[model samples]
Target: MSSLLPRLHALWTKETLALLRDRHGLAALFVMPVIFILVMTMALHDAFMPGASIDVAYAVVDLDNSPQSQALVRRLDKSGSFRRIAVGQDLDAARQGIRENQYALVLGLPAKFGERLLAPAGADGQPTEPLTLLVDPTLNPALQLAFRNQTAAALGTIRADELTRRAGKLFGLPVSPAAERDWPDEIVSIAVQNQRSIRPPSSVQQNVPAWLVFAMFFVVIPIASIFIIERQEGTLQRLRAIGLPFGHILAGKLLPFFVVNQLQAVLMVLVGMFIVPMLGGEALHMPAGRSLIHWWLVAASVSLAAVAFALLVASLTRTSQQAVVVGGVGNILMGAVGGIMVPKFMMPAAMQRLAEWSPMAWGLDGFHTVMLRQGGFDAILPDLLKLLTFAALSLTAAVWLNRSSQP
Candidate 1:
């Protein structure tokens, strides 16, 4: 055991110094992710943050030219969530506008909207007066639903006012002004739903953890390339002649790259926190009781998982070109399959189901659980275990492959 320690330590030292000597590769370990997260996040920042200003251009068709209908249009305009692009009497034109992708939403007030507002609920418990929110199919489904809810909420507010007006007209009795201030308990249900399975309120929360997982997996190229280079140069034979155990030698190769990937993860995360907002993006808001340790532990686990895959690629490849092809192409493909490139929530249901097998998916799931969902160790445990299990299996296969190839 004492002799084993020296072998591991010396190997680790040698591997670290060698990696550090390649300044470009070392920089890439940190730089590529920072570039990816920042540029990608910045590109999508507006969609994610949306901020105080509403950018979804919309048109309203007030079919009921009544006082109530006009008032609703006025209210929508003042809210700033919807800009009045084209307010027309023709509903067909409004639908056409949406079809052409000219508008994000089309607010359609039905005929007799004023009459419906003046009436009470019918025998059946249903809204006879339903607002039709015609959304552009081109817009994100999640964004479409958010627009629906925001409009619904506005309608909900004006509902009391309309109700009060109706009561005064019907009974000749006015509601007290003070009573209007408090909202009654109610459920406002709108159509065509979307929220995160992870349940984040915005896009930034989801994307940050996702790209971080992709970046973690991207370490495969550099790591596999290094291993292939060493093997081809007969350095693997030289290291073998020193008589170290296979486990110690493998640990030496894995640990330095593992640490490098961890640093990459940290740098990418910090970029999200500080750099994202400077380019008119939202900072990643934290869930309650978040700890730095939780971040580190999850990052460390994910780094190990990534390193194991790198080792697997390095073991099987016969040349540096093969390593680059397998490692680079594999990372990109896995990223797509894992919900790193396209959100799983946005993917087809079958693809979403299939994505569960990806290591990057597990890593992102664990990271998001802690970073966005305020999940503790117990909450992230299932995902973390899956990642660790994958790592162990891949590492075992890599060791077997590496030892069998050795003289």
Candidate 2:
């Protein structure tokens, strides 16, 4: 056992130094994933929480020009729900804004909006039509629901105040505290807001971490190529000739790449947490509820899963060309099935079902739970077990296949 440890350590040093000497390869290995994390995180963050940003854009066309319409607009403006509001009498411009920016919502108040609130019961006590709220169809469903609900509440508040004020003016008295009783329970009136343009869901949190898992697994290509190179150079035979055990040799080779994968994982996490914000992008914040130890365990599982996948590809391929195809194209195929390329939530029913069993999908789910969701080790145990199982099976398969093919 003592000799085994020393031999493995020596082999690990050899593999690591060989990788480090190849500056261009190491640069590609580290740099590409970092670039992807920064770019994808930046591109997709706003979509995840549409209103999280201070600058939510929308327009209000107060065609009523009355105290009621003005009050509603002022309330919405103060709510900080929107950053920039284009306020004018121009319905055309409001429509244009909704069409131009998918994130933008438009509110239009009709000319007789004030009169409708005060009319009480016209024939029957029917509720007045809702306010005109134009929303982009492509907007996120959650954001759409939130925007609609918020608008409803704001408009409801303004309507009640307007009704009370109008009743006081009609009764020839200043508005009083008892004015709350003046709004008849029978009067069912809400503003008439139109619904318009919207865009697609850009679910950022799911995507960034999903692609990060993909990039980690994609180390398959380079690692597989290295494995094939060393084998072709008869390095494995020389080690065997020098009395190195096959298991220890394999362990030594993978240990360095395993560490490399962990480093890559950290690089991606650091980029997301610190560098992204410095570059004018929103940084991913760690959850207060999660312990750092649990988070590291999840990170380690991801690295092991990725390296195991690479080892399997490396062992199965006989040449560098085959390794590239197996690692590159094969990982992409796995990624597609795993919801790395597309969100599982957005996928079709069949695909979503299949993704439930995908190893990459499990890895991503683990990350999303701890990093974004309020998850700890307990929340992620099932996924961790699945990942560990996958790693064991994949490594076993690689070793078995290599042994079977040997002359």
The C-alpha lDDT values of all candidates are 0.73, 0.72
Per-residue error (Å), model 2, residue 85: 3.2
lDDT value, residue 167 of candidate 2: 68
**Candidate number with greatest lDDT:** 1
Residue-level lDDT of model 2, residues 325-397, one tens digit each, is: 8787877787889887776776899999999878889888887666655566888899999999989999999
TM-scores for every candidate against the unseen true structure: 0.72, 0.72
lDDT of 1 by residue, 1-407 (tens): 44877877787787777677766566556676677677767665555433345567888788888776776676666567556788887878888888887887888888878668645567456566677888777787876887787667656666777777667768978665323333553443332222334333355666777777777776776777778877889887786777656677678877777777777766766677787887676777654455456766777788888889888998999887888789778888888899887877778999998899888888887777676666678877898789888899999999899878765
User: Which runs in model 1 stand beyond 4 Å of their true positions?
Assistant: 1-10, 17-28, 46-54, 61-65, 78-80, 85-204, 285-290, 347-349
Show the lowest summed lDDT stretch of 10 residues, model 1. 188-197
